[model samples]
Target: MPEMNRQITLAQRPYGVPKDSDFKLVETDVPEPEAGELLIRNEYMSVDPYMRGRMNDRKSYAPGIEIGAVIVGATVGQVIESNHPGFQSGDTVQASLGWQTHGVTNGDGARKIDSSLAPISTSLGVLGMPGLTAYFGLLDVTNPVAGETVVVSAASGAVGSVVGQIAKINGCRVVGTAGSDEKVRYVLDDLGFDGAFNYKTSIDYEASLSELCPDGIDVYFDNVGGPVTDAVFPLFNLWGRMAVCGQISQYNATEPPVGPRLFWHCITKRLRIQGLLVSDWADQHDQALREMAQWVTSGQIKYREDVVEGIENAPEAFMGLLRGDHIGKRVVKIG
Candidate 1:
């Protein structure tokens, strides 16, 4: 058995955007799994915007990642040995192993995966948290309809990209906003968005909405929540629905960014706005997986990953995600 372990440890608490100094790459001996546990080496690890919130000391829906804690993340792993019930040697699984080369699990959170269906790393993406977020966020919250106008922010991201395409598949008129013209083109030309705008260069987000969603927006998937969400707020038609999946723009703000309030419109238009966490919807994942898988296989829905080459590169890629430097779901390859 290999006796080496390479891991990234939290070295310091970050005040804003995390820096290299915040993480320490440490090497040690591989740990032996206890009874009812599995010993595994992590393969691919996920890097997401929400993990940034965990770094801060402030309270959130989930407990923050304490200083010195290995950064928490989703990972794809191969079980090297197991004493856990239902888990076996050589079984591939999705485990919450965080940022490390080796991990031990009680088998409670480890879900067995079949590599025959889709890429296993996809468990961290389109068929995993991001996929589940897009699936339930769109269906349960937005409750879209055929031929209705649906608008989304961060249109080419892991969550937003799938969100928009699923809306399209439902027969909605989809329009999206992304950070670059290239991303806008990808949304419009490739993702089948009826229209898309580069939010970075657009003179007015509301104006862009007016031009693209002349029929008025029936649903808004709010991914980048600062200014872009503000722009979509007023354009919503009566009885509109909004799914507040993520707010990437404010993730790195040193101070709270100023945003226009549209509380009155929510009442006047009878709009609904609610934030959703994918973890809270575990009961419905089987249905989501079956439906989403069919869509991917049928080519009616598409997903993309902005894959970074190594585990050491996750922090940089994640920092870029906060800066809108990436156009799709960011994944770090650890194998």
Candidate 2:
């Protein structure tokens, strides 16, 4: 008898916000690697805001998850069987193996993990896509300079947390927005942001930004769009740069969101706003990873993880992430 494999598959395309019923867990025989392929036993799998977008049927940067397909996500795994020259049975690797306990891959899009540098899970968080997202989004896209005021939304999250710390490292006065007071404290105290506010309580985002960013926002790292962005626009300094990363605020909108039109701020303030995907800087990933690893290992950059145990709980974990129930990088530990 072969070992059993468990997977979470997309059961239905979400109409708005996803529900547990939208996902189905299925069991199958663990697959054997063919020649030139590797068999992986996934240890940690990521659940992120972008996965919400993928649950819809519309095509974006990546294709939508099809019904019954294993939900797409980054995974940290150990190679259990390998016929590929680049991998060995004992090697730990990071791959887009989705929401599964076992996967077989051709070694494409898979990278070996150096567990000595950091925990294997960081490969899915700080040193992985989220960290790189923060790195290139802030530095490459926005080019935040020293002495500037940098504000990041979702500041306690995987990407935004790193964004704030990196901005601080660059000598910028960093401000962050999170959902709760506890998250705000984590951002300000633990992550070293100069200022942070709970957006949920800060009913007037403009007032919050006005108080925190007295010099005006020079660089805006936007993770949650909508009202928060509307408020930030008015506070943009001349020649400000905005990195539009994720719009978790509008990811689950049943209808297109209507808000104040603020493009005039772009004209008057000469603001530069651009959307970003981590893969946009694929050519620079190795360099970024090396730098991020050093920062993380040396305590220059701090990270927190919200790990949910068991593959069976992945759906609930993902839903909780969407609801802002987790404080940091939300991942599922598959046993």
Candidate 3:
């Protein structure tokens, strides 16, 4: 008898927001790695906003997840067995192994994890994709100079939190917007942002932004689109730069969202807005990770994790993530 592996698969494509019935969990025999392949026992699996897009039946930057297929995700796990020359048993690695407790990969897209530098979980969050997204999205895309005002939407999230901290490290006055008051405090107090506000409770977006960003926004790292982004456009300073990361607010829309037209701000302010993908800077990830690791070690950057235990609970945890229930990076500790 072989060891059994529990896996989560996309049972149905989500219409608007995902529900419990959209995902199905089943057990299967653990697969054996062929020659040149490695077998991994996933320890922690990441739950991200981008996964919401994958659940839809449409083509985008990446292929959509098919029905009854394992949902795509990043995982950190130990290499329980390896036939690949680059890895060995007892070594930990990070790979896009989806929502399975055990998976076999050809080692093409896998990276070895150095546990001595940071926790293995950080490879799925900070020092990993989200961290890399913030590093390049802020520094490369926006190119904020010291003394400029930087604003981040979804400031308490995995990516936005890092974006605000990196801006602060660069000597910029950072302001962030979160969904709740507690989230706002975490961004201002724990992450060292100059100011933050809860967008959910705020009656006037313009007033809130104006009070926090009196100097106007020199650079904006947008994670949640819609009204939050709408409010940001009119607040831009001359020669503003915007990094369009994820549009979490509109990710689950069944129809196109209608909002105030704001492209005119781009023309008037000479704003440069660009979308970013972490893979765009894949060639330079090693260098970026080195610098990010240093910041984490020196306490220049701080991170939090909202962890759920068990593979069975992944769907609920992921649904909560989409609902803005989790404060930080959401991961499932798979058994």
Q: Pick by lDDT: which candidate is best?
A: 3
Candidate 2, superposed: residue stretches over 4 Å from native: none
- Please, what are the lDDT tens digits per residue for candidate 1 over residues 1-335? 75688777778888777888888777779989988889988888998889888888888998988777788999988999899889999999898999888899898767888889888888898988898999999988889989899999989888999999999888999999898988999888878999988888988989988999998889999987887888887888999999999888787778987767778998899999889999778888878988888888888877777888877777787778777777777888884
Model 3, span 1-335: residue lDDT tens: 67898899999999898999999999999999999999999999999999999998777999999999999999999999999999999999999999999999999879999999888999999888999999999999999999999999999999999999999999999999999989988998899999999999999998899999998999999999999889999999999999999999999899998889889988888999999999999999999999999999999999999999999999999999999998879999996
lDDT of 2 by residue, 21-59 (tens): 899999988999999999999999999999998888886
**What TM-score would candidate 2 get against the native?**
0.99
Ranking by lDDT: 3, 2, 1
Candidate 3 regions with alpha-carbon error over 4 angstroms? none
Q: Is candidate 1 or candidate 3 better by TM-score?
A: 3
Where does model 1 exceed 4 Å of error? none
* lDDT at position 118, candidate 3: 86
Residue range with the least summed lDDT across 10 consecutive positions in model 2:
53-62
Residue 314 in candidate 3, Cα distance off native in Å:
0.4
